[model samples]
Target: MEPAEMTSLRAALAESDFAKPPRINLRGEPIPDGLTTAVVYQGHEVVTDGSKPLRGLDRVIGGS
Candidate 1:
């Protein structure tokens, strides 16, 4: 994705309340707070954590 698109997406996520931190785990159970292994991005190279449940928005806009 283009840098401009990434910036726009990041801004939109910041404005939306539904946008929460991402989670990274192999288990089916949810991960606890402050234990994120890394800041994963939904589409491109944005910073996201695993603080909230996964949603459609968490998925990449286009093919990754």
Candidate 2:
């Protein structure tokens, strides 16, 4: 994800009541999951300026 997207997400997570680091699965792999509604930017669909983006490695380019 881009830095700007991340910055916005951080702000929203900070305001949330249940924001927390994700836990790992039994195989020692971190489960990918997030909570938050998101709004897609008009010019860039991949770009979201939503209150919550539920960001993770899965959302980042090359992170896959």
Candidate 3:
């Protein structure tokens, strides 16, 4: 992620209700059964595993 994008994301996350440390399981190691890439925002969990692709990233970063 770019520096400016990261900064924007940080700002947005700060306004959310239940933000957590985002994780990306892109490595080869075993990530447990249910572990996957995710972002928590406003008490909602958005997950992106192999079965589904991540979406609305631009919106997440305060972009159109």
What are the per-residue Cα lDDT tens digits for candidate 3 across 1-64?
A: 8999779787655654323433442445555684555666656665544343334442453353
lDDT of 2 by residue, 1-39 (tens): 699887866555444322232322132333357233332
lDDT of each candidate versus the true structure = 0.44, 0.36, 0.51
TM-score between candidate 1 and the true structure: 0.30
TM-scores for every predicted model: 0.30, 0.28, 0.34
The weakest ten consecutive residues by lDDT in model 1 span 17-26
Ranking by lDDT: 3, 1, 2
Clashing pairs in 2: none
| Residue 58 C-alpha lDDT in model 3 | 29
Prediction 3 TM-score vs. true: 0.34
Residue-pair clashes per candidate, as listed? 4, 0, 0
The candidate maximizing TM-score is 3
- Give the better candidate number (1 or 2) by lDDT: 1
Model 3: CA > 4 A from native: 19-37, 40-64
In candidate 3, where is summed lDDT lowest over 10 consecutive residues? 16-25
